[model samples]
Target: MSHLLRAEYGPRGRSAGASTWHVVRAADPATALCGRTMDTDAETRAEEEWGTGLRCCQQCGSLYMHEVPHMEGSHPYS
Candidate 1:
């Protein structure tokens, strides 16, 4: 289950990292691994660039963990 790094912007300041990075399956941009509808127009980033410090979607991180257990600690921005 390959995932792509993208962005999910919600209400302004109405979230805990809601405007952070999101994870979407490489095959689909319709919805993210966190179950949030993704913005198809959003540009996706390479998995290598999903490093720390950036805001990341928690739900996506959880789901991604199950998707790739070996890649633990790879999901940044928790």
Candidate 2:
């Protein structure tokens, strides 16, 4: 897990390691912000709001981003 959690850089840019799972659950943005559903859509609008910049789970309706960093380099801000 530690090895897999290395910084990954692609065309878009750098991203979390393997162990650092980025889960996107289907949900409603409005309802999620208020703590309701948890679904994610592949739409441009939703994607913009729930951009890859996210490093944490934002329970907006159902859409969300789960970023689990390594204990050694778990920088939530970066």
For every model in order, what is the number of clashing pairs? 0, 19
Model 1 vs. true fold: TM: 0.68
lDDT of 2 by residue, 1-78 (tens): 111111212345334222122333233232233343322331213333334554433333233223323354567665
lDDT of 1 by residue, 1-78 (tens): 677888776676334434678888889966888788887876677655555666778888788767766655766854
lDDT of each: 0.73, 0.30
Q: What TM-score, over all chains together, does every model reach?
A: 0.68, 0.18
Off by over 4 Å in 1: 10-18, 71-78
> For model 1, what is the C-alpha lDDT against the true structure?
0.73
Per-candidate RMSD, Å: 7.2, 13.5
By summed lDDT, the worst window of 10 consecutive residues in model 2 runs over 1-10
Residue 3, candidate 1: Cα error in Å is 1.1
